[model samples]
Target chain A: MNNFDVTVIGGGPAGLAAAIKACDEGARVLLIEREERLGGMLKQCIHDGFGLSRFGERLAGPEYVERFMDKLSEKTVDVRLLTFVTRIEKTAEGFCVVTVSRDGLERISTKTIVLATGCRERTAKQVFIHGTRPAGVFTAGTAQHFTNRLGVMPTKKCVILGSGDIGLIMARRLTLEGAKVLGVYEINPTPSGLTRNIHQCLHDYDIPLYLSHTVTRVFGADRLEAVEICEVDESYKPIESTKVRVDCDALIVSVGLIPENELAESVGVELDSHTKGPVCDCQLMTSVDGIFSCGNALHVNDLVDFVSASGELAGLSAAHYAKKAQCKVNIKIGNEFLYLVPQQLDLNADNSRVTFYFRSKAVREKSLLRLTVDGQEVFKRVYPFLRPPEMQQLVLNMDKFAVQNGSDVRFSIEVAE
Target chain B: MKSFNCIGCPKGCLLCVEEENGEFTVTGNTCENGKRFAISEMTEPKRTICSTVKTVFEDAPVLPVKVSSDIPKDRIFDVMREINAVLLDKRIDRGDTVIENVLGLGVDVISTSDILNRK
Candidate 1:
């Protein structure tokens, strides 16, 4: 039986960071990756504008991840490439992770486990694009993989169904590859991607963006030949009279990404409905003892920098984890937020320098984010503007608030008059 | 007055540029980079492009490359033509220039990864 201090799943940027940090903490760490390479999605993300916050330089995704891969090479973390985790069983000591590889099934025991499985793109069917199963339909990430990694063009002409970041980037990428991107149709009134992405990717290429519009149906049998695009009303119901047929070979969807948390859920970890991920504490520890969730498995993050940051924190916490009773308290949020990560705080653990990631429910010109504890205002910060697409990060010293087991920690954003 | 979204950073500040007698006045920039970006947008818009070049390696079909600096945005397709024409037969490390002074723009297309060499 193989035994380790920590086991980090999914060899993406987050997993690599976790394994490296855990190794640096002098803990025996094992990194499991389903793919042969370690870069994960970064391998397919050939675009730049990554690592602007972490490395302070706008680097290509591969370059950004390679920096961590370089650091990982120097560490003694045990890496298992082309290994898939099948099951995780809780034990008295810690956990027994069952995995399958070319060698066959094997079980490894670890004191603590870090979930960094990342997120999966919502497919066309998931977004309710009614049609016969076609070959040309692809998620934005899949299109990116085919184009950037395999050097294969997924479509000659395409209509992107979402304004998400990946969709916006692919619009530019496919255009650069001599493909004709007709237009990007977004269901929401406002663009779902970052302001920078909209400017750099779509606006730069002169690709038309139709807001409050969505693809309702596909009209093809073998390969996608056309799609029915229609405008939506306030409740997001498609307006039947506004249906317009757009001729295109492919339909690339970038509706949204959902965190890959099935493994965590299988381990009996409580999930937050808002994040669609594990309900985590300030240290990124999940409800399950000796188990921690980070990166996309904790919450879908807008930036890769924040994903790596959460992975590092989870790795550090896992490396130093010990079996102890936790005094956890929920951190409530008002309806103004789209979602917030680190849904709770373990009062028993160190509460200083707690990082919280959140997004606004809608666009706000001027607002103030207030933090209240036990009916008393503890912290507040004013913002010039807030948007759902752009996530915000705040690191606060929760120790100063004197948060106890029953402390009422509430977060709300108030629009400025 | 011409309005532009300064892509200097992710903040995407709405920059309003005014020109009078070949002199530009830019506002709504949070940093000096934003101001410089606005001026460049007004004069000659330049952008850094990252893409892949064909490689002979079976394990890695394409190698990612990016301009050493920003190039004229209008000449992007021209540069892409130059990039797509290359069939890299030699194994190069990261930061190795795939093309020097690409299309006489004074920007070299450099490999962003050493995946080929690693394999």
Candidate 2:
């Protein structure tokens, strides 16, 4: 049996960040990762566009993770690679984390816990694509990990479904690996990925992007031989005569990503159906006291940088909880948005500046993002464009709107289109 | 009728162009960018080629590389031939300039994938 002041699960950006923050607060933290390496998905993501705020430098995923890992080593933080935590049970005092590694089954007790299991890619089975059971089909992330990370292309002639970030990234990846990408089909009229990715990956490669289109059927008995694509109406229903057949050996699907919250659910934490993550206030804590969560495990983040930032909040909260800290007030979500973090309010807590993370329902062009409390607008900003691909983060100083008038302070983002 | 689709955006606007005896006419576009797109698609097809060449880099057997120019769609094979013929020496790090001013297209092929040292 092992024990620590703080215990963090899943050694991705969130876990690593939380562990580092806890250690920074002079807390003995036990960090566990199920993977053989410290870096999580960041390891396989060899692309840049990470670490703009945290490091003030744009870096690839691995490089961003290396920074925190180096700090963790300097702080002498204990991390167990390939250590899997199977169960977490809350006791009268704190919680017990049961884990199993190559050594054997082990249990650890901690004052506070943070879950950062991250997310997994949505597959063909989840989306229900009409296709034959073929060998050449794969998820875009799986294919990327295989070829880009493992040096093995899944197939030669490929047709990608979903113009998601992963799908777009793989279109460029597979094309470079001596494979012919027939086309990328998206059911939506607009791509579900970042704009820059579409230009740099698909347009640059001349890989046809069929928007408002979908793969109606997948042909081939044993291996993927071809695909039938058809255009869809505004209602997302397929048009009859718009069918086009493309011969391809493989099909890659990047439908979307969903948070891994089996552990979160097992702990009886309240989940938001929109984000498919835990519903909390602004502190990033879960419904269960002393148990916090962040990263893709909380919500599927479009950027790794945001995930790290979110993790920092979870880490800070965990440290405070270990020391038995409390906050007098809590901020709740308002409207046109889903939810906030840190479900409880601590009146005695001194942290004034608060960062609110949220997501929008649809894409908005040229709108004002406003924050209000009890029908009074406190903070507002105008933007040219707002996208769901990018999570919206707003930093508000409670000192700016600190008041004794309202007992319930609601903080939600409203679009003034 | 000059009804062409703008492959520029996911919107995929169906632009119509009417040429009365070699003159120019256009319609069916939502934005001005789509206007430029229709003119270009009807006149010439353009695309940017992003692919990696042979690399002697350390860790990564394959490095991410992209073309510098939006080459004419027909010149894809030609540009690819030029790219395939070259050998990129090892020690090329991520974001390193692999090929500069490729094909006078004012674009340079860059390394997007990282190669790490074993030590």
Candidate 3:
């Protein structure tokens, strides 16, 4: 029965930052990781284009995470590796986390908990890709693990089923590793990856990207041999007449990522239908008091910088957590936004310098995002263009809005006339 | 006019470049980096690639490495060949060069991770 002031789960970039920040705030912190090593997905993401905002340099994923690992080494935080959290129970004092590791079952009590459990990729079965169970089908993240971490090539000639950023990067990675990436087939008309990734990873390597096309079926029993591709309509239904079979050894799926929240759900945390994560407050605290959510557990963030920023905030808030009544007000949004983080605001706590992350529902030119309180515009910002793939972040003085517990705090986006 | 997205930053501003007798005029750039990127794309394009190399240690099978600077885009596979040929047996720290003056491009391939040295 170990006791701690704060316990940070998952040793990814988010959890690492949270542990460091909590330790810096003079709180006794403990970090638990299920893997043999830390760094999480960053270890497999051995590509550049990370740390541009935080470090002001284009660093590889290992390099970006190593900086945080170095900072965490100087702090006095207890780290447990190869440990898996089985359950989290709410206690009268705070929380009791049950974990199983090489040493066996152990329960730790903490005043507050920060959930930094990252997201998981949508698999082939999850996306409704009907196919024979084959050996060559893998998610983009799985393929990345095989190549970057394990040094094993997962495909020889493969067809990618989605245009997500990881899939785009893999197209170039496999090419550099002497594998032939036939083409990337995205079900949507618009590419799902960042514009820069489409250029640097695909265009630079002469990898073709076919939009509005999807792999409806995969053929192979022992190993993946070929795949059935078809042109999809606006409703994403396959147009039967447009079906074509292509020979390939593998199918890499990069459809989407879903936030891992089973532990949060076990603790009775309410989730937002849009973001598919815990409905959090301005401080990144979940609906369940004393339990904070950040990083991909809060929402699927496109950039790691925002993930670390949210983790730092959650860590600081959890470090100062006390049992008290909360005054919460829901934050409403218009139909123009795909989703927004921090679905609610706590009037009882500090509201100054609250950060919001959001994405537009569609591509729009000359758009304006407005924040209104009680039908009066409190803040507004103009953008030249907004895309769904790129999430936006903004920091505002929320205390200036004079929002009460029952006040209407709404965020809306409108295309400029 | 040739239009393309700038890889300068995540903003991904759409840059339009026009060529007029060896002089290029670039528009729609938010910063000077985008302008320079467009100019380089029109001429000799260069890119930085980060990849892993095989190592002798069983604990860490591969070590991550990257070019010290941007190399010519066409020489990527050529550089990969040189990187693949190396079978590193020493524990090198980050910024330690794996290959010096690789392919005479005046850039060294350096290790980007110090995983072997981590205790």
Candidate 4:
């Protein structure tokens, strides 16, 4: 009487891969997509640089996602497009997912649910750019959509704020379309984007990047006319005397991205403060049993290859969940890490070969990561250098660590002097 | 010696290429891709460009396009011009060539998405 064995709640790279893997594992899967398109944000992201690790080819976003869409077509999974899940109720035997679409409302019951809800971009308002409400200010994602998907020039002359990856890519995209980008202003001392991005997207194009600088105010009534810029101190407070004005038609901001998890929160899933996403174990299972999370819903990932890897792991876990009893163990990490995925480990499950994704809190040179179980050093790896923007994935055979219930498994970083 | 960060991936390796006695050696690269990149970069740099093209479709105003192969780094602007000149009157599928042998570079400009064919 169940509608499906697995219900995937997104259509992005993560959800698509999760559903595909679940179906391949002989489970009846249902993929619900709120958007009309199945590829999610990748549809608007036409720039190449995707699938380097997975496919070993520099593919554009659309082309990278097309491979998954092609495989999804052959599966027996039910595809729901332009549908919205209103609420989820924990039933006696399983969970009830109530959805609404153009036709009407429908309820489906499933044993397991996978949340692959991607993320949202932070807007100018979120960053406190005060001024008149103008039409020229757009998030980097919106600008990319306008230019790549809709074939519209968002701005003729623009000033970009924030040195994130999206903003840098759009700078080049806008310039190629004959727009003049004045310069990219970032408040942080170091750029927030990947090194390859800063080099290829900004440096190769000769776009100037100003560090320790920020845009304070937008100066226009209807359209963007000019913006007030200033230098910030060590505390990130603006230096009042260092104010400057730059005139431009638009302000493209790529401040940051926040994981979308309202639905997960509604279900009372525990969220990690550092990642702003659901707390998951080695199998990607959430705090609530029968509910799993992957991709950006678990945490923002730097590469789509890792996103697919997590999705596949979650899908496989969901399919074989009923096989054994899951015993959870919290894996502790030091403050030197920005965040770590798989916050816990399932001792009862296969402890061999667990992949954990993490990033350094800041730039660290000649750093060594120490993994200890019960006060005994289990593993250690040295990194020549680590940056916050680049996420590193480490695969370990937990069996060798010999960690068990109540075992103090901790991860800490140290500078190799 | 000339230094350039490898653009192969997000892991930006500070690559230094030194040509001593006509023998080229690349240092600080983490992988083989970076090594090849250094050699090619030192010899003749090549680049690939991705942009949008104007289309007649109402629902989709513009379609994403990219060169089928890499071209000389200097010809990026020229390749962009060739792609911009075309106003696609017919709906083309993803990977479909919009311009064949564009500017006699033997590289075709292909649509990156099937968004235009939806209508």
Candidate 5:
């Protein structure tokens, strides 16, 4: 049995950042990761577009995580690798987190917890495509893990579905590995991945992209032989006669990412119906007091930079709540945008500054993302573009609004251009 | 007018280009960037090259590699030669400079995939 002031779960980018921050704030922290390695999914991602904003230099995912891992080594944070957290329960004292590692089953008690379980890929089982059972079907992430990290090519001729960032990246990765990528299929009329990724990964590779289309049926009983792709209407129903059959050996799906919140649910944390993660206040505390959540486990993030930044807040919040730091003012979600973090704000909240990360329902061009409190706009910016696929981050100084000390503050986005 | 699809974006804009004398007028694009993109496609096209080459390493069969820059559409075969000639040891790691300043294009060939130690 082990006890700590703070228990950080899932040692991915979020958990690592939170643990490091908590330790820096003079709190004893425990970081537990399920994988044998400490870096989490970032370890498998070999692309270099990461760390543009967080580190200022464009680096591969491993390099970006190496920085955090190095920081952890320098801090007092304790890390446990290959540890699976089975359940989390609240007690009269605080929270009890149960896990099993190489040593055996273990229990830890902490006053505050941070859930960073990350997310999982949506697979064919979840999509439920009507087809004969065949081999060579893989989630884009899984195939990427195999080919990019493990040096194994999953297949030769392939058709990728979902046009996700991972799928787009895999299309390029597979192509580089001597695999024939017929095309990428997306149900949405536009790409669900970042614009730069679409341009660089698929467009650059001459891999065709079929928008508003998806695979309706799979062929081949033993190994994937071919797939039937068709265009769909607005409601996602396939239009008749639009089916196009393409010969392929494999199908990689990158449909979407779902937050892995089973443990959170076991602990009875309130969930945001929209984000599908635990409902967290500005402090990153979940519905259950002192049980915080961040990273992809909180919400699927488009960029890892946002995940690290959000985890920093979760760490500081856990530290402050443990010490019962004083502050006032609560921030709330306003119109158009999905939800804002720190559900509550502190007027005295380190007036240094606060950055809000959010997403829109649809693509908006030449717009203004505005931050407001009680229907009055406090901050507004001319954002040339915004997309549901891309997260929009807005930073504002709490000092600007600390004077008002308004009880009900809200944040939202609107077009001003 | 001849209709050719401009593979500019996922939108796949169908371009209407009419050539009179020696100049071309292109239209049917959603953005101004698309308009310029269509003209460039009709004139000279370049595509990003992504392909693996033989390596000297045996820890794994091959080390996944890629051209550091977009290759001229016509020079793809030529680029493949340069990529094929090089043989890297199993020690090749991701983002490592596989071919320094490849083809004098100021871009280095790099490993796109991480090659882990075979345990």
Candidate 6:
């Protein structure tokens, strides 16, 4: 069996960054990808707007990942493309990762494993769009692949359901390609995408964004012909009185993204109810020791920059991880937050430099985010606005918090009265 | 007077531009980039266009390309048209210039990905 200090599954940005960081830390690393290419979904994301935080430049998705891929190619880490890890068994001596590739089945043992298996887009079935399975119905990612990668026009006239980032981007992309985008419909009262995307993609393009509206059902036999748009109430209950019919040839859905955690679940890693990713400590190690998770596999991050940051953390931690009793301090947050990453803190480790990624539960104006340890305020920042679609990140120095194994850590957001 | 929300960062600060005596004053910016973005929004807006160029490779039908620098906002469609018309006949890696000094503009239409040469 091949052996390495760190084995990263999925060669996306997270895995690439993780493998590279581990290798840089003097750990023998192996990166395995299921696709022929190292880039994950970034390959098909041709639009610019990435790397604003990391590189301080507006780079395209491919370009953003190309930077990481280039650095990784120069490293000593072993990269295996078109290789899929089938099963992972926790043995007494680290973890045994079984794989299936062109050469057939093989096994590799690694001291620590980083699950960077990214996320998958939610399909129409998950959103409960009732209709005959038509040819024109496509997910936002599929449409992007057809347009950006294959150079094929997936639709002529389309109605997008969900104002998610992909849907908003596709609305502009399709419009730029001479397609007719009727309008973007969202069940939520507010837009689901970033405000900047709304300004540039939809508003700049003259495309309409209809809030509190959704596609209840679609019509068509051979291809999509029409869709039933209904207005939803505060509780998302469909108001039958406000049902309207819109004619469109295609229905593109970008409901949401779900973290791929079946592999983590198979290995008995605890999952968080809010983020749907593994319950990880400040070190990014999951409830199962020696197994870490990062990137979208940990939580669906709005920005790819944060994904790379989390991967770096997980990789650096995995490389330095030793079999020792972890003293973890639980972190609690109020209902003001949708979720927070690094659910717990490793008291035994250096908790001084912790990168926290979080999002408010609702749209908040003039809000203050306070981090308190042992009932003492350590850090607090007031933001002008906070939206669920935009994630906020902070690199905090926890040294002054004087945290201990039994210390209570809490985070909360208070809106200005 | 005009207003814009700076997309330069996640802060998304609302920037208001007021013109008095042919001079512009930007306010409500959380950072220096916001002021610059506000000035650009009031004057000439520039944006970078990223799209795919047709390729001869069958395995990879299109190669992703982008302008090396931002162009005038009004010239986005012109850049896209020039990008769409070019059909790459030779294998080119990332950073290879697809069209040098495109349309007399300072930026070059360069390949942003190496997918065409991978196969």
Best by DockQ: 4
RMSD to the native, candidate 3?
Answer: 0.9
Model 6 agreement with the true structure over B18-115: per-residue lDDT tens digits: 99987889998978888888888778888777788898889889998889987888888888889888999999998899999999989999998888
- At residue B17, candidate 1 shows an lDDT of 92
- Looking at model 3, residue A142 earns an lDDT score of 96
- Give the TM-score of each candidate: 0.99, 0.78, 0.99, 0.97, 0.81, 0.96
* TM-score for candidate 6, residues paired by index: 0.96
In model 6, which residue pairs have backbone atoms overlapping below 3 Å?
A: none
lDDT of 1 by residue, A23-88 (tens): 999999999999999998998888898898898999999999999998998898999999999999
lDDT tens digits, residue span A27-54, model 2: 8898999987777887766655578666
**Higher-ranked by TM-score: 2 or 6:** 6
Per-residue C-alpha lDDT of model 1 across residues B1-119, encoded as one tens digit per residue: 99978886678899989999999999999999999999999899999999999999888899999999999999999999999999999999988999999999999999999788764
Q: What's the number of clashes in each of the models?
A: 0, 20, 0, 0, 9, 0
Q: Residue A254 error for model 2, in Å? A: 1.3
Tens-digit lDDT track of model 3 for A1-417: 389999999999999999999999999999999999899899888889888899899999889988999999999999999999999998888999999999999999999999999999988988877878989999999999989877889989999989999999999999999999999999999999999999998988889999999999989999999999999999999999999999999999999999999999998999999999999999999989899999998899888888889989999999999878889999999999999889999898998998999999898899999999999999999999999999999998899889997999999998876
lDDT of each: 0.93, 0.74, 0.93, 0.90, 0.77, 0.90
| Selected candidate, larger DockQ, 1 vs 4 | 4
Q: Rank order by DockQ, top first?
A: 4, 3, 1, 6, 5, 2
Docking class of 2: incorrect
Per-residue lDDT of model 4, residues A138-221, tens digit only: 999999988988888999999999999999999999988899999999999999998888888888789999999999999988
Per-residue accuracy of model 3 over B34-109 as CA lDDT, tens digit each: 9999999999999998899999999889999999999999999999999989999999998899999999999999
lDDT of 5 by residue, A332-361 (tens): 565566655545564434655666667777
Return the DockQ of model 5: 0.13
lDDT tens digits, residue span A267-342, model 6: 9999999999999998999999999999999999999998999899999999999999888888999999999988
